[model samples]
Target chain A: MPDPILAARELTKSYGRGPDRFDALKGVSLDIQHGESVAIVGKSGSGKSTLMHLLALLDTPGTGTITVDGTEARSLSGRKLNGLRNEMFGFVFQQFFLNPAASVLENVVLPLKIAGVGARERRRRGMEVLEQLQLADKARNKASNLSGGQKQRVVIARALVNKPQVLFADEPTGNLDTATGRIVEDILFDLNQNHGITLIVVTHDHDLAERFQRRLYIRDGLLITTDEEHAA
Target chain B: MKPLEILKTAIANSFRSKLRTTLTVLAIFVGAFTLTITNGLGTGISNYIDSQLAAVGPGNAFTVTKTDASGGAASGPKKYDPSIKRVAAGGRPGSSQLALAQSDLDKIGAIPGITGVAPVIRISPDYIQWSGHDKYQLSVSALAGAQPQLASGTNLDDSSTQTQLLLPVGYIAPLGFADNNQAIGQDVTIGITDATGSMRTVAARVAGVEQDSLLSSSGIAVNKALSTALSQAQATGAPSTAVSAWTDATASFAPSSSAQVSDMKSKLSAAGYTAQTLDDRIGTVKTVINGIIGVLDAFAVIALLAAGFGIVNTLLMSVQERTREIGLMKAMGMGSGSVFALFSTEAAFIGLLGSVIGSAAAIGLGTAVSGALARGPLSDLAGLHILAFAPGPVSAVVLLVMVIAFIAGTLPAWRAARQNPIDSLRYE
Candidate 1:
């Protein structure tokens, strides 16, 4: 297969220092290929979320390196790193992170606005994403007025507005009911399968992990095993 | 983000906490309002004084007096010298000064820049009577090239061979004239006691009616012809030498630049004469007025700075309240610089709103107050507006408040910009 879209080697991260320090990731290593749907499964404090954060370039690993598209992450400047994240990656969080005071359209167009897109183009692209999420009719409604599933859909539309190469969903459906969570999950998988976007979902749910094409189970800051490794 | 987008966002965010922002703005408003009004007051009075000075027509002339030969005036009284005659100083009552003789006038006229030198001819008329009316006590003096503000008719005809005088407005009703218009062109009899103690009367025609001014009030302005006529009549049987001595002289120069005028004045000083321009005569009044206005302005600025503290408090609270929002924006790839710009721009917008409103209100109220005063208590002082607003000063006040607000916002904006995204997002 082609080189992995995101590669990590012996990555380690810790919290605090000295006696109080706790290792969040202990020499964890992984690779995520383009157009692949992968699940990082672990209970709370198992370092699954920490590993995802490192892969997304939201935080730096204490040791080792991450390479994105054949370029070392540490080699890039702060401005270039932020630009890469803005132009190449998207994120959906469990809490939704929607600005409740803003309209659904405004929340979706935030990244485009930050990218300095013109008002007309921002509105146009924002509406297109909302339409894809089946939220076009609620574009002008305040985000606070939306139901939990609809709010998650708006967050997914915002994540998709930049047309990023990688979509990272950290417990994206954790706050939704089972039926709503299944719908949000299906939408994320659809983006990965049909749109060819790389997907990395961080979750502790065993049933949710079973649906991904690949699953890496982590425990005590170390990856216990991967299904692909077991198959090999 | 683009500057326009940042500014729009800042403006929208500033209104997020309406009551808090409004109270801060109101504090700023009080400062800007007071500043604008005090500034207008200073401008109005200065403008009126300038116009009045123009009316006085002394731009090209100044007064010259003889200083002690020792350079400075003596701090203590000295024994009187017999050779130097003393006379009452014109304009300043009760002060007798050593007289300037005809020889002094010739010397002053010889100065390179000096165009003319004439002693301030003092005439003490006993009374004035017009058309069989009862005689009224009179204070008459030479016009001395002054162009008094005319209420009716024209100025005294300086070149007219016939004696002419401008009747003060207060003298009109007492002289039995129906009004200022009726007094013009009418002849008046001025009676004076000569050196022999004999009373003699001379007739002079009223050329115009003079407005009562802060300066030069209560005196009849007489042209050169009338002045010479009255002097000759009063000096009858006195020594020609005694008549030629004067307390002070009005000297004229080539109306050049101030630098050149000062040079000419220094040359006079070298020759033992002290020269004072019209501005010099009124400088004290201007200084006192400006000093008072400066104190008032300081109070206004103090109020503005206090309001600046209110801006700090308002913005600090906003930064604290929006901690999560700030983290979210930073996580969305916004730079620290953009965050700082957002907060500071909001502060500047608040200042802009308050200053614009305050200055506009000041202009409205000041205009009305000036009008009322002009028609009421200050009716006698024509062409004087107590408050005047100039575009430049008004704009400066607005800019000043905006800068103050921007400065006040810096600390809070810096704190917001330096917030760590992970920690802020984790904040409950």
Candidate 2:
């Protein structure tokens, strides 16, 4: 097995200060290796969201350190953090944040454009990703005109266009119906199995968490390894 | 992103918001166009005056006697006070003469670097006649011809020797002359009343028929010949002093250079001589036109200010609407500087369009208005008016407007750039 791609040591996150302080993550530690698909399952307000945010570097930990692919994520700032975030991870949120004014293709190519990729190369790469997601036909349509499944597909295409190492999905199927959720699930598994990408998913669904190779359940800001529970 | 690619993105985005872009562009257009047209008119008017001065000749200067039009003695040691208004009781008020005298001319010629002088003279009861026509009943003028200073023809070699006659232009001889040039060197008889109130016929040969005169053609040519005839006739008998009264003298001169011209003017003015130069006339015209243009530029500035406010509002609203977009961009690895550059570049595109429209509109309006004015009251100043639409100045003004527009867009663009990406992305 390869070394851990992401590691957290006694991670903690708090909102506000003093009497109003709310501890979202309480001294939690975790490890995930390369090519691994890990699902963090928890009820709402159980610190799973805070742990995922820290893992993605979307929010800094209040205590302890996170090293992503060898570099310490906690100490990074400004351009270094931005570069690491852009190059290392592809993020999919429960709510697809697509620019409604842009066409599906434009929305997909946006990250590459911000990364200052050349136009021909960016378009070529963006089209390849869209085609892979079976969204080539809707490329020219405005995002506002796309359906829920198609908009999610375009958002996935956008996230994957830069070919990041890890796909961090926060409730990827939370907003979709059962049938559409199954399709998204199949696509996420296919991306992991075929491309050998590390997948870290944060979801509240009990049945969905059981399918992953590894499951860490967070309750009241404390994480319990499902394998450790089985061993006990 | 490369600036060019970013510019393309900005332009496309701006194009997407058509109404907002159009309104902002319109504001800029109105501002820039107003400035161009008003400035054009001012420039055209001043140009017209300069052209007139040029036609009047740069070297030549004017000198007038200290007298009113009615032959009354003019106020001595008085300058032309622009603040004071002259009012006539009833009839046309006798205006102070702006012309200088022959003595002033001689004095001006005596100044260092002084050249030649031609005295400009206008006679009263201006009329003259030949033998078949009656005397003094017809008011004609005889222009006093100074020696060696022919307006067009051969210069006088000896003003005292030659009784050679010179004809006034368009002088139709009494019915017996065959051809137009027939009276060029032929003898023509003139009738003049003597001091004793008796009419006499005097015969002289028309030496040369002048094609142009400082006075009316009905008057006899007062060449050295005619002057000799009148002087001799006066000695022979009490001939018409009334005919001599019809004559007045004027001198025209050419200075060596422009400095000599200024010196001559100052010297003439200092000596209680009311004189005017071609340059001074042009300066007066420029001053008047500049005032008009200044008012127009002021109005343009007001319009530009209003447009600037419009730009600020639009950009601010854009910032609000694009909060998530800005965040997404920032998270995608665009630097803070890129964010600033993108917004400012978008505003610059709007400004560029506005400048193009303004410049084109200004040229169009200038062409149309100048064409109309040419057929209207400004016809007299048309030559100078046409020269006023100088392309260099207009182009510069258009560029200036574009720059001002970019400056106006700066603040909103800066505000858009400074937005915290985390909060912005969290924005609904």
Candidate 3:
């Protein structure tokens, strides 16, 4: 009944030029509602990551448009776009891009720091998020010293630290074992269901897609199917 | 991000490559050290000269000489003029100068700003002896208003009727005195040959002992009382016409400003006379010293520029190594300007560290060297320090090095700021 939180109209993106040009996204259209758990499923080179990048406003589309909260992405100034990303969106990647030399709390507090929060408040909020992820005891430990599963949880805490409206995860468990992958998946579903935060997961794993409320299967730079499933 | 946060991050990032950063800092240190030392040397010598000028007490007086109608000393020989009187010149041995007559002295005294004029009476003392000690050849001259640094006792009392003279420190020992204090208050006999070629001696009390100076090295200063007594004795039986002519005259003026002095000198120049202030007399020496210091400073600047290149190299490598980190920060919404500021701050921090260390070290070493020299080879020249560091110049050097570092950092900072987040993030 409410307007979709994000709407992309016939989005297309390409890399390089001339004969070497490859279309990473071609005429892909989608809408994501607030508090929805959606999965973008595709094999390697299927443009699922490119589509997620476009919707998250990290990359510009070659054609068509992306709208967040009813405002076109291209119409926003660079400062406004960056501010939107900083305050309203969060990202997690399979690689867990942490500054290894820094303490876990430092990595978790980065977004708040980018937002120019005071030191005392940044620490308090960072510790609060780490506590939520059951990582409070390890706040001072260096990011490099953590186990893969623990590192993923730290990344999740970082994504949640800013209280973002949308969380974008690109292959969140690709680097983890099955047990750890399942744990990460459970955390994502919990954030979507309990906290009512919109979740967009880009993955090729079928089991991962099955856990979402809806799945958009992409192939050869186009979305081939949209499947909706009822809650278990 | 906030400027404070950016600065903190930059400081932390600069030390990430410790060896590279330290080598760059060392290069900067070399430049800063050389720069501070040379500048200190300039300050030291100039300050000493300034104090010496103060001690000399030539604030309002200058030397005036009759200008030759044909040519001057620097020019080639000219046809002789019968009316011009030539006499032995002071300071330059084996050379003669055109004499200034009573008319010339009266003309100089009439200049509006000119307060007083006194002829430099030629009193050629053949020798001087203290009590019964051996006679030593002496050069005695009237100092007019000049004041020399005294090792002991007071300067000559020019207004006192008693003839007085200051004995040079070199003569203190040979003249049979135990020390400078013992030499003062003792009367010395000065023997002069009058116009009749007969030796006539005049006794003058030693009012003080003169310290050795860069100027007035071998001269004993005599007060007006002693000078007039010697002049009157030397002119005995001489023609009245010959007694009225002088080689040169010391002209005094009310110098409200340097501009006024220059104006007075121009007036003297227009009147067919050359006037030289004490500063003008010693100007050549100051020029030569300053030229040497300038050359040394140029070398230091070149070293700093070479060190600036080292900064460029170090920062470029750092930008390359931190590509991924830069991308992450950009993706988190740190603006391009902030990115540039981060790198620039790092460069400035390195400069601050190196320059502060170098200047502090130079000050330490210079103080010690100056102390040693003062007590050793330079002991004769009292009140002269070879190196001095003033707060203003020291701070200027530090600030200059920092500006160089900031300029050197711009290229690398620009490169880092221009990087595309997507491309940098995707870089493997």
**Maximum-lDDT candidate:** 3
Model 3, residue B110: displacement in angstroms? Answer: 9.7
lDDT of 3 by residue, B340-428 (tens): 99999999988988899989999999999998998999887887898999999999999999999999999999999999877777776
DockQ of each: 0.46, 0.35, 0.54
Chain A (alone) TM-scores for all candidate structures: 0.96, 0.95, 0.96
Quick one: ranking by DockQ, best first? 3, 1, 2
The CAPRI-style docking tier of model 3 reads: medium
Give candidate 2 misplaced runs (Cα > 4 Å).
A1-3, A10-12, A16-21, A59-64, A74-77, A219-232, B56-288, B384-390
Ranking by TM-score: 3, 1, 2
In TM-score terms, candidate 2 sits at 0.66
Residues A1-232 of candidate 2 have per-residue lDDT tens digits of 5558999999988889999999988898889999889999887988887788789877678999998877788667777887877787888878788888888998998878877789899889989999999999988898999878888888788889999889988899898888888898889888988998889999988677777888888877888755343345
Cα distance off (Å), candidate 1, residue B197: 9.2
Q: By the TM-score metric, which is better: model 1 or model 3?
A: 3
Error of 2 at B164 (Å): 21
Q: Order of candidates by lDDT, top first?
A: 3, 1, 2
What TM-score results for chain B in every one of the models? 0.78, 0.54, 0.80
The most accurate candidate by DockQ is 3
- lDDT by residue for model 2 (B298-381), tens: 988888778878877777788888888887777666777778888888887887888779978888878887787777866543
